[model samples]
Target: MSCSGFQPISLEKPTPEDEELSDKLMEKVRSVGGFDSEETKESKGAVLLKLDQIAKEFTELLSSAMSSTEQVSGECHIKILTSGLHGLGVPTNKPDIDVLFVGSRLVSRLRFFSLFYIMLRRKEGVKDTNAAPDAFVPVIRATVDNVEVDIVFAGFPSKDIIPGTLELRDDNILKGLDMESVRSLNWCRVNAEILHLVPEVDNFRNTLRAILVWAKRRGIYSSCLGFLGRMSYAILVAKICQLYPHALPSDLIKAFFELFSKWKWSWQCPVLLKPSTENWEFGDLAWDPRDNPKDRAHVMPIVYPIHPHINSTFNVTESSLQIMKKEFNEGFKVVSEVHNNEACWSKIFEEFKFFDEFQHFMVVTASAADDGRFRRWVGMVQSKIRNLVNFLEPRNCISSIRVNTEHFSPVSETNKYVRRWFVGLVSQRPLRAKDLRSPIDKFKSMTVLQARRVGFYTEDMKLEAAYVDRHQVEDMRKENSHFGAPTLSNTAAVGTGEQPSTSSVAEKTCQYDETTLPIPPKVRKTE
Candidate 1:
């Protein structure tokens, strides 16, 4: 049993009557600006022009600025990878530009420091360096003509500087590179072929959106940053093209799932954590898991359903997985109910009349399913809907909604099973202080009321118990001098006739056999 069940139904290419229905459906898309919407075309054009202007301005600025700086020993080169090169067809509202700074001579330590200083000085007007450096970089973001451009300066002296220098240079270096040639590479061509293979546009957009959201939440949205975020998206897209040759967006997503499911390691974007363990920073890097002898170069998993530190960093009780399951189940119900009722489907179609080939497919599927007109139509509709659901099913789909670890790694067929288990754990049992680990080792954090809340302890009873425990501890310390041994000072003990050693009291109060506590039962596996 696949995530979406497989059902066989005969689907012959539409006859004349079916063609007529398709024509009518296509007309609806045209009315709504399906493939040839003027607004979409105009928007795309505007994005291209804006990117072009930015690239030109940047090149001009570098030419003038670098010429003046004698401290800069090499010729400055500007590389631009814009929407025009991505061939996304849609107009980009925020086009990403990759900038590289290449030098003729080896950059001295002093020169590198000077370069860093210049950037710091440039950002001084926008960001306060008094803040942590990691926190400051995100605030360093600036806009030129309403276009957000992220600039990274990589100084290269010679082509063969590092052992894997050529590969890295080829992957990242964009000096004197032809934009047209780069866009026309074997990979790009492969991507285009895959795009053509997609039968529906909606499925393509849905899959792309899912991947984007996943990347964004994980803090890996750009290829320039590392392999996990934007680079991962690109790699998946490229892989789709390579495997299917003419795969559609739905096909791509299905393929991605198939590939991802087979992966032994969890898929996570790696972030460079500070020594303080309070924050994370981005770098030009990739996963080098040398310890894994079989596939040493494979990327490490960074995306988890529930971040282990979910209680602390996110300040939410529910894990990312739990939220995703709830939302996905809800969405599934909505889709199913809408499909079951002809009037509801009609209402949806009336509002979103202007649909492309993709939209037509959805309507047809729904209509066919509801009408009980054709068996194949119903199966196709269900299959497509399941695919859509799977693409949008993950916790990352809903912005800022966290889920439990169980949601991502579900042990049951139904999400309800996981939800019930989570609720039972929080309600029936008290989560011990020791059980909650600090998201960061440096922080001596405890999962008190706040932590439990973030962990999705919605029940008022659970919250009340935590509060009660806290109040009891405070009251006990105040009332009983012997029981609440003051380790800090002898002031409290002085007032009492007898003084017990702080260590002795601590030993009596805190002593608990770890082996006696009952461990929570693991979730039953779904066959």
Candidate 2:
């Protein structure tokens, strides 16, 4: 039987050229650090172990405290299960490891946010700890063993203890859970389902890896900033693998772009691994564009392959959808040519040239008082860059928002706390400074409110946006030449390990404030 959303498109196997292309794609992806090294694997494993240890310690302490405070019948364990790419076994060279703390009914959210968060903050190996208990999906973001880790919480209402053997695949696990827990638990559950539904897990991973590298290089991978996310990319590739069950990675890659490039990504054509079977009680949370205007409005809706079935690409915007479509069509052209000759793989995986492409540009600069505030301030700035893109996208003048997801330090930047992001504001007609006044002003205002909500805003923390042309962009790029490759900040780990910036539902949690591009002053204007 076919494992895809529909029957197999074709059982035809890949030709010799497909094998060659797959091999080349794998090499290119690996060269750009798309896949993990042995050392990275070891480091990531160590971080997971340290995280588990912390969760166990916190649970033990909580169990003791609860026993003393009240009459507890049985001891329930809090299990720390790794999620995201790390848990999915398709992690890149530097995956921001995401782990979920599954607790019992006795363990409340207050304790996890307070006790577990504090414990994580003080843990010897953990550093750069931050928490967002008030966010839509509260999480404790930290780093252990030089690898970023975001610890999310989920407690079962029907269980006294979350034993180690408990499987989240069970639908009842989400019963009586708040929306927050449901979202957090879905992190692991969705990844598990993707792996389960794939016809060939290894092939799916390789195909997805190549696509991820390509998407990153093309600057269309960040869900936080109005682009397809890791989950979306994974599901897209997995679907291709399902359609071509026996196809190799090379064939899957070709099919991916070919099918998606032409597919109408509309409400009538959502990419689903399975049908929207409402078996559980959280139908209200499930995605149904007909009932929910917000869901109906999503330009590119990619449904999660599990219960709740939320649009994994919930953050995608019209501008982003158009931008991604362009890339897909071009990718199809390149990958389809692999049979005749070796496709220009280099062109496919080249670093996005923000300074080269487009005429007018929008420069967003995030400035802080000092090193202590710079990272956090920059993160808040990143979270709202998409809003700016969203607003600008609607204008008739702005054709697309070409954002370079990598971080670039300004040249001759003496503030030591300033980082600049360059965005290619593709406008049809010649653009002037005033043309973007309304959107730029609105974007800055949104940033201010978001910063205040996140409580990271201060007098010294500043966000400034400006409109410039390609000439000015070149000037700024040259000024920052000595700064070398983009800065690899902890925030650069865009969950998928591809983009330097992330957006959307990924940031709805604490990760929201920590993801973007700031503008440089070297190219303020051009005559």
Identify the leading candidate in terms of TM-score: 2
Candidate 2 lDDT, 77-177, residue by residue in tens: 68778777677777777746778888887777866776667667767877777666655566777778688787778878778767657666767767799
The TM-score of candidate 1 is 0.35
Best candidate according to lDDT: 2
Models 1 onward score TM values of: 0.35, 0.87
Q: What is the Cα-based lDDT of residue 316 in candidate 1? A: 13
Residue-wise lDDT of candidate 1 within 1-527, one digit each (tens)?
12211121222333464334334433433343234345534544454465444434443444455455434444433332321123433222233222222222333222322333233334322231110111111111223333333222333444323232223213233333332122112222323433544344444543454444333332223221111323234334443334443443333444554543343332232211111121112111112233234223223332111101111111112232243334334333433443344223122223211111010010110121111122212212221221222222242322221111110112322221111001011212443433222211111112123223223222221110111233333342243222111111111111110111111111111111223322111200100
TM-score of 2: 0.87
The clash number for model 2 is 14
lDDT of each: 0.27, 0.71
Looking at candidate 1, the ten consecutive residues that score lowest on lDDT are 356-365
Clashes of each: 21, 14
